[model samples]
Target chain A: MRATTIHAPRDIRLSTVPDPTITAPTDAIVRVLAACICGSDLWPYRGENPIDEGVTIGHEAVGVVEEVGAEVTSFRAGDFVIVPFDHCDNTCPHCLAGVQSACDHLGFTTSGQAELTRVNQAEGSLVKTEGTIDDALLPSLLALSDVMATGWHAAVAAGVRQGGTAVVVGDGAVGLCGVIAAHELGAERIIAMSRHADRQALAREFGATEVVAERDDAGVAAVLELTGGVGADAVLECVGTDQAIRTAFEVARPGSTVGFVGVPHGVELPVRHMFRRNIGLAGGMAPVRRYLPDLLDRVLDGRIDPGRVFDLTLPLDEVAEGYRAMDERRAIKVLLRP
Target chain B: MRATTIHAPRDIRLSTVPDPTITAPTDAIVRVLAACICGSDLWPYRGENPIDEGVTIGHEAVGVVEEVGAEVTSFRAGDFVIVPFDHCDNTCPHCLAGVQSACDHLGFTTSGQAELTRVNQAEGSLVKTEGTIDDALLPSLLALSDVMATGWHAAVAAGVRQGGTAVVVGDGAVGLCGVIAAHELGAERIIAMSRHADRQALAREFGATEVVAERDDAGVAAVLELTGGVGADAVLECVGTDQAIRTAFEVARPGSTVGFVGVPHGVELPVRHMFRRNIGLAGGMAPVRRYLPDLLDRVLDGRIDPGRVFDLTLPLDEVAEGYRAMDERRAIKVLLRP
Candidate 1:
């Protein structure tokens, strides 16, 4: 099997890797149908995060089951499914509480950007579709593995409600999807802060009522103006930079919430301001396992097409070009067929 | 009129000040029956917070309305009432959303440790009791003004649930009151971190299932052990110190919330640990105005006696002793009668 491996900072290569096989009673081997580069992938790719030589590069994908262990009861070979990034036992205390990301026996299948990957806790981590999905719908189904579920978690964690105003701080793929999630969750007004035309266009198409090209104070001012000076009822911080985190605080109303799904990179909360304003901050790695089922249903029903985030697509062998395009800001997100 | 004023660090003096009078259409003048010293007051008395010379020193009180402005429709002269520390207009958007502390026109009332004090937004700030309370109930009723309401808000914000375990950080009046609040909110087990015998006894009486006489790591370990290795379901942080804040985070389980009612003073959040653990932090100044009605009902019905936090009693003329006792740790809280 061929896979994308991160050897070091700004260093990625397509190379041959051993095919995956069932390693546990609850494990299932999946033949990857589609995989894509994630913003979080950029973290280790940029050397901002530590990475070992030849480490597997991606975690989001749609795949077909090739083999299943004896204990796998809910799925078998030939099933098309969406695999959540985090693998958890559905019966664990944390998973039962709807926080699958913190499941006691959680595992991950990092070789997602390859021809085959092994999924642990198969019954809990993979959600099977009713029937085989067409090739055209692959990108959108693949999104359900991470980005879409993440956007949904961001909106839900921020307590976005009907008639509420939602402000998204990043223009990345997840941020654009957050606009869609907020709209689906009934946010009356969606504000996307983006200067890129392509991402902004998708944001508007996904139901962003307004787009502020400015960053920092001007951006917050624009949002406040749109909200009658009350600021947004909920703000999603999709970029983990310090500036984005601070902007998230500045653009939120006194008692509003800031749901931050971005992996933090040198971000520090201004405790005094947060306390004084009574703003609530609730976010972390998305428990995609908890939302994958509903999101998959929406995608299958034609209610939403989150795949619009993929501005570029290519075959798995061209994964290097996909990473380069995203890193150079030429593409919002790139979809890859294996 | 005579009032208690802070002349400098550790120096509280009784002196004559101008009598308060209704100054706004929504204002009311009250003759104070009782006022108490809160742990927060120690910040200025101990020089941790700067104080202007001769500034009045108390903000919690019960009194009889001396006069009401023309626009004050719900309150009138001769009515007995509890005045929340902060004044708010109940009709504002924030107030309507149950966040009275962030009300659009929020303002603080003068310390009612004087002969007369002015209450702003009188219609919303003053909660009139059914009748004048007897002498024995005065201290408890006065508590409804701040400490008791704050405790209730802390527990409520932390999402205390039936049969849940709750950990309270801080042994001050508010922390003790939080134990009472958690019990009333149906927390099956309440662990109070306190070393003072008197406060510990009060905690036990308020339904604390256990008391740990340690701080930080030791305290968190004790709480976890008490909960059988699972951290408390909710944690109420009533102490604004950095150590107390950290302890609250260390003692809460994943997906549980820490309700912090303490006025933060140089406290910083551990963002990385918080995110990875999926813990939620939500709290600010207690919206006393929002909880007064319900808490007052509880006090009136004898469901809880929050006034027990006051371990020392003194006349208004002995205001210096009240401050000295609290500052020297001789009393958890001090009550003063005019």
Candidate 2:
């Protein structure tokens, strides 16, 4: 099987790797259909986060089940499915609580950027599509595997309500997707903080009512001014930096919630700052599996087109090119067809 | 009028100050009937938090209204009221959203430990008792001004469910009261973390199903073991240190919440650790004014006895002694009578 491999910093290669097999009773062999390069994947690609040498890279994928273990009762061969990044048992207490990201049998299946992949805990990690064979819809369905679900999680956790307002703190793909989620949540107004013209235009198309070109203090002041000094009712913090989180906290109205889904790095949150204003903070890794069914329904019903986040698409053998495009900000997100 | 004044670290003096008069159109002057020392107060009392020399130091109090400003429509002389630590305009947007503590008119009425205290935003900060005060109920009513309300906030914010398990971290007055709040929230099992014999007993009496006389890692381990490794459904973090916050995060079940109400001084929360399990963190200064009515009703109906927190009593002139007993841990809390 041809898969993308990372051997060192700024080192990515397309190499032939051994085909994956069902090694566990709960595992399933899947032929990769579509995969994606994530903002998080860039952390290692930039050499900021250390990556193990020769590890198959990528966690987001849409695949066709080739074989299912005896223990896998919910899926079977030839089924087109959305494969969530994190595989889980789906029967653990945490999974029962709808937090499969914290599943006791949690497994990070990062071989998705390949022609074939083996998924453990298949019953929990894979969700079947209604009916397939729509190549144009593959990118959108693949997004439901991770990024789209993550954006939806941020909007839902922020308590975005009908006719309410929401402020998104990042202008990345997730932030753009969050704008769409906010619209789906029935938010009357959506504010996107963006400095790039292209991203800002995409944000507006995704339902952002306004865009602020400023950063840091100026960004917060702009949100406050837009909110009439009371602040937005819901804040989606898609950037995990200290400044972004602080801006989210500062822009959310008293009694409002800030739902953050960014890969939090070097962030220091003081409870005192949040407590003084009755702010509620809720978010973490998105339980993409939990949101699969609803988001899939939306996709099937033509209610949303989340695939637009993938501005570029490349064949599996060119996975290196996709990563390069994303790492250089040349693409909002890249879809890889395997 | 005599008030408790902090001239320096460990230097508390009962000194004469100008009588508080109606300072704002919405202000009301209340003659102190009951006032208590708080754990947060001890920060300034011990100089951990710098205190402006000669500043009035208490935030919790219950008293009889002596006068109301021309614009004060809800309070008048002879009406006994619960003067919450923070005063706010009831008409502010934040206050209207049930977060009076975050009101634009927020005023920390710190003269509560004095003979006469002037309260601004009288309509929102003062809640009238059902009838004439019961001398024995003074301590409990006074608690509604801060500690009890704070505990209630923790329990409510944590979303404790009926028959769910709750863990109370920190054995201070607020923590003990949190046990009572868990009971009111219908939590079937309440675990109280405490090392003191008296505090543990008080915790059980207040509704704790069990007591863990442990601290730090041991305390968290006991809680996890008691919950069958799933961790508690709701955790109330009454301690504000880094260890306590970390323990609270570690002790909360995946998808569960930790409601913290302590005055955080040197705590830095790592969002990554919390994100891994979808742990929800919500808490801050108690919205005492928003809770005044319900807590007061509970107190008057004999549904709770929170005043037992104050085991020591002293005249206002001996406010210095009251501080000494609390600083030495001789008393769980202290009540000063002016």
lDDT of each: 0.88, 0.88
lDDT of 1 by residue, A263-303 (tens): 88999887877777778888777888999878988987889
Model 2 lDDT per residue over A172-267, tens place: 888888998999999999999999898999999989999999988898899899989999999999988888899999999988889989988778
Give the Å error, residue A134, model 1.
1.3
Q: How would you class the docking of model 2?
A: high
RMSD of each: 2.0, 1.4
How far does residue A40 in candidate 1 sit from its true spot (Å)?
1.1
Interface RMSD of each candidate, angstroms, one decimal = 1.3, 1.0
Ten residues in a row with the worst lDDT in model 2 chain A? A124-133
lDDT of 2 by residue, B278-338 (tens): 8878878888988888887888789999999988998888888888998998999999898
TM-score for the first chain in candidate 1 comes to 0.98
CAPRI category for model 1: medium
Q: How far out, in Å, is residue B251 in model 1? A: 1.9
